[model samples]
Target: MHLENLITQKVKEAVEAIYDISLQSVELQPTRKEFEGDITVVVFPMLKLLKGNPAAIGNAVGEYLEREVKEVVAFNTIKGFLNLVISDTYYLNFFNGIRTDQSYGYVSGGQNEAIMVEYSSPNTNKPLHLGHIRNNLLGYSVAEILKAAGKKVYKTQIINDRGIHICKSMLAWKRFGKGETPESSGLKGDKLVGNYYVAFDRAYKDEMLELKSRGMSEEEAAREAPILKEAQELLRRWEAADPQVVALWNMMNGWVYDGFETTYKNLGVDFDRLYYESNTYLLGKDVVAEGLEKGIFYKKEDGSVWIDLTDEGLDEKIVLRSDGTAVYMTQDIGTAIQRVKDYPDITGMVYTVGNEQDYHFKVLFLILKKLGYSWAENLYHLSYGMVDLPSGKMKSREGTVVDADDLMEEMSETAGSIAAELGKLEGYTEAEKKELYHMIGMGALKYYILKVDPKKRILFNPEESVDFQGNTGPFIQYTYARIQSILRKADFDFNTNVLAEEIEGLQDKEKQLLKDLEAFPQLIQAAAAQYSPALIANYTYDLVKDFNSFYQQVPILAEPDTRLRNFRTQLSKKVGEVIASAVGLLGIQVPERM
Candidate 1:
């Protein structure tokens, strides 16, 4: 495991024998390109110790390293760089461990450290959209990766179930003639509530314009202000066990939760904890008051509370409005405090939200730190970028927002159509075709979104994303199918002795394939350490590309030489397992057939 570290360890040990400085500072880096060799170490840092020219120092160290370090089978000096190549024998060791071990190229790294990732904190006022899909997938994928790396991950989602927004729906429902519910109307509860929300907006705007013409302020004529006040009273009534308000509140929230559950089930996002905004928004109000008493916050004349963050290079954020109402900030601060009080020893809290809230997290984190919570430093804002379409930005108000359910349905249909067009499945039953469509379509969707760097905005192109070629998830899955085909046909019994001994019997394709294999453990650790799934995505694609190239250049079961043929087939089997494992981490299932 960690091939790069092992090679660096050997080189550092060899250097300690040649010179007497702390080898801890001796940094070893991998070669950037293929021609420079597998790993390269700069000798320029060690030049002063050698007391000679850069080239002379490089040559002396390179010669000493290759002779002294068994890990370095051959090394050479070019200028001040010591280029070290691990012998092909090392690849055999790496490949053998990966092939034979049950959990190869993986470690329980965080050692039971606990972290919480909160994602898809959508409002119940509307349906889950494409933005929520991206948030959910990233959160779910990151949770899996962290768990694989040995962290105890707590996946939580805060349902935004209250506010003026929720009130709008209630107002629309009350003002409209019919006393209809989602069940009776045959409309999704969230969508029904959302329709009411739109209705409220349209009516409120028309009323406000007329009021403005009659000499009242534009804001005064907006009955939404009164409706929103009424909704808040309704929320209080529900909280205080008022039967009528609770009944309607429960009914509306039920539909939204049902819709959300289906999306999560299809997208493969699970939560260990669920927080409701209505419950927690008021929880932090007192905490802000506590801060005020401690001189952490100042109360304005109008009774609003503010945290001046100018000293921290941030604008002051309002924790409570003049009327003593909590905003998103106040609620988050409360939730964070309550979570820490509940879990006490949580090692970290990772918030998986859009990058738009970078400033919000920056302020929230600093405020937490100022409040003397030692673990405040562990709060990480995993800021992911926006998901734009090939056409343009998606606007919710403009009805350009793509619903999560709609997108999933479209992908499934696309997969079915592609399956039909390719004619890959001859005489397949409808049930079988549906299953293939599910895997391919879902796999294509997840891969297309996650393949890019999380912080980089993605332009999703339906045409390019679903293509069965290039660096997409389907491409890797397609490669898996090919390998499965070979394995089914070859049925080769792998011999460990031959695999260990005949490392050079491998073709140039075989050697490159081995190098690709060695990158797995390093790749796994790197991806987890950086919290970047794209690293794993890129590595999986590279391995498949190398394997595909090897497959075309060298035949497995078709070879005349029994030993060589068995070796290649066994090698293919090893690659197959790794691919399956990596793709599984990405929340993409590799169908046995597709």
Candidate 2:
């Protein structure tokens, strides 16, 4: 058990024995740095029972602990705070127990109910962009963190594959080009399809302008545009499952899917299962009928289905249109139910979408609960704010968005330039240097994004994120590399097991390092509870700071005492192992040498 648990149990017994009173709870906090103690007990809470001088009560508790508890070696009381000093042997024992366990902080598997995390739900009309990057990174990191915290997790996404927006790209590709393919044009399939999506917007705008010039109102011109009319017709045909239209739809969607696979690979995110709107759009219709029969929904004269949520503080939401076409809400309801049917063990789901759809998820969850799904109570919306570049917000239709692939390439180039200026890659082959640059660049990007609170907006700057100092990824990476260098230079075998019996005369820096290391397992559990990777990110920075302080103020390799040198070396190795494990939870890699 940890020192605090032992102290808590002892304090309860001490109070009962000395004061003839039973205390129900004990409060413990980390001792202040100005005080010479490892743990502090608050004496004020026992005031109600004892009804005596606080200092006297603290003194009695301290005497009781020093006599009864082996962990408590010495104690001092300042007003209501009682600080107790622990023995060096206690810390030494703790370190020796965990030194050789590689998976010290992580739990292998959990017995809790499974959770499904949905992220990167991209539209097939365009390639992934900056906003999608934040979604993917947050979703993937949260899943990994949850797994580390001993929760069963499945990563997934719902692809928006069928709609009029998709048809717009298909029509543009058919009309504007004689014949073009990703293979023939020497471009990624998503980019080639995305170019046509932008072209369709341009053509549609010109058509609206011509109609307005002929004295039509702006709204009329927009509604009467021939290009838009054709796109709408294509959607109707697609809904009807016309052979020719379906063939073209499948062909274009196939290209987009292929391109998306490459981007997802580069971004280092994956899904256990995929859901498509094309397959799920018709899912809620039968459920809607069932609800209507059960008086949960109402139908208009025009033949649309809607739920009245006025009592619930939300406006009436339409699930199906007058023409019997399913809306986004209808498909979403179906998809959620379908997932439950697929994985009966899933107790909850996390939808990682932008903040713009916050209301949508709230409504979706409420409807599910009304439909009598008990698991709906556990659903959560991982809503996040939009990401903005220095230039401004991005518009995909105008081709002004920062493409994911291009942004990654730019980050790599920035890392290369900075590394070259610092001249840090001497004695490395060209291929090794190139790989290292990519690793550093990607690490910087992931850390910079994941370190921010998900609810807050970000003004992402490539130059600012790639810095090798301060609270950035490359800085921590460099520290790990420095530790590796220390290990490599040691002539003695640092891998030898450290015995608690041989360790003695612990320094203040070493004690602080051990305390910081002791908090890792609890930190992972807390991070998972908050669903925030920022907790893990900042915790890592703090651990690195502690290790750096210990490295500078204490002697390791050059120590005259053999036992002291061996123990310090083992401590350094354990710290580096934790650094690697922590960064791995964020989907980042650390280098052995910088």
Candidate 3:
């Protein structure tokens, strides 16, 4: 067990023995401020039993625990609270344990609780934007955290590859003339595909106004529309499984996936599997058929299919539209059923979609449960908030969407500029500097987005100039660099046996630093349990800040006292290790320099 548990247990046992009462809830927390001692536990509940003086009861408990508990060096009572000072031996023992287990602070490859985390379900009509980055990072981090907590994490993505939007892009591509592939246009697939989508929109608007001015019937005008007709024909061909349409669809999709792979690589997000709407949409037809056979669904006169859940307080949902074509909901049901059939023992599935789709998942899960799938209860929809710009919420109609690649480029350039200003990149070659720029930039971006509560909309005002001064990724990174500098300067052998008694010779700063470093594993476990990465962000910042202040106030190598310096140096190294492991939990890359 960790020191917190060990110390708290001893204190609880002491309370039971001394007072002859069960110390059911003894909470021991590190002192928020230094003068409060290393840890504090309120003794107010025990006060009433003592016939009333809180301070008197606290003092008695404090003295008793200090004398009995091996974890406590000394104790005092103030304002009904028992403050316990952790003995240097407690910290020294903790640090020794950390040193022995290389991956002491992290627990990956969790038990057989498998999860499928779906994120970045981007439409094929557009390139990824800033909004997608938030989704990707959260999904990626959640999977990583679950994996660390011993879950079999399955990171997955669904490509919104077929829709009216895709049809629009194809319509524009067909009408706009001379055939140009992503290769011919020298453009990324999404961008190349997106350009035509934009073209279709523009042309559609102009033609509609012209048709109105000429007083043509709306239906007649729409039917005669070339782009609209082309998109309709393409959709028909696509649905019919025409060989040429299928080939073109595959080719374009391959390019988009290639481009997407590059972006995921840079963002440190990857998936174990991918589901395409192209594949899932067709599967929905079969699921709808099964639901009908099982009497779980009813059909409308127009040949449309639906699930009735009014008793469940959810509106009846359309699984398929008239004319035997599936809508969005149809594909979702089909995909979900397919997944369960594929992995019957998938203990859980996490859908990392935006909050707007909260109702969708609610109904989706309800339907699954009604369909007699007990495992449907294991499904979880993690609805995250939007990523708004400093100006306002991102609106595609307002043309305010921030393209992901552009944002990364801007951030990387800014990082390079700052690195040059700091002169920290002096020893690195041009290529190394470029690599560092991207690493730091992406780290800042990931940390910025993930540091906020996923349910709260975030304003990215700092952008490329995200300060390293406070609770930022680079600040934690700097602490690592500071520790590395200390290690480089130290001349002692870390492998040498140093007894717990020898740690008593260390400085006060070393003792304090080591004490804080011991909380690393607890912080990680808490972050995972809470499913709140913001907890880790806060913890990492506090740890780094504490270490930084300790380093600045106390000299590691300046002391002429050999044993003292060696012990302090070792403490600093352990502190760095703690920070490294904690930061790694968020999937953030820590640069050697700011």
The per-prediction CA RMSD against the true structure, in angstroms, equals 2.8, 2.6, 3.4
Best by lDDT: 2
| lDDT (C-alpha) at residue 474 in model 2 | 89
Model 1 lDDT per residue over 491-556, tens place:
556554455576454466787778777767767767766777888888899889989999988988
Best by TM-score: 2
lDDT of 3 by residue, 1-594 (tens): 766677678767776777777766776777757465788887766554546677877777777777777677787777877788877776776676666567776676655677788889888877788889988888888877777667777789889887667777776776783688877878887777767777887787678768877888887777676667777888888888889877777766676777787777777888888888877877768877888999998899988888888988888889878788787777787888888777665777888899999999998888878778777888888788888777777655323468788888888887777767777766788888888888778777877888888889888854433556677776677678878877887776755546688644545666667766676667766766667778777777777877888888987788676666766677777677767766676778766654
Q: Write down the RMSD of candidate 1 (Cα, Å).
A: 2.8
Q: Write the per-residue lDDT of candidate 2 for residues 1-594, one digit (tens) a residue.
A: 767778999999999999889999999988999998989999999998888888889999999999998878999999999999988888888898899999998988776778899999999988999999999999999999989998889899999998998999999999986689999999898888899999999999999999999999999999999999999999999989999999999988899999999989887889999998888888888888888898888999999999988899998999889988788888888888899899888988989999999989988988888899999998999889888889999888898989999998898899989989999899989999988988898899999999999999999999888899889998989999999999998898766666767765689999988987888888899888888999999989988998898898898899888888888988998899999999898988999999
- Quantify all predictions' global Cα lDDT against the true fold: 0.78, 0.90, 0.76
Clashing pairs in 1: none
Each model's TM-score? 0.92, 0.93, 0.89
Worst 10 residues of 1 by lDDT: 497-506
lDDT of 2: 0.90
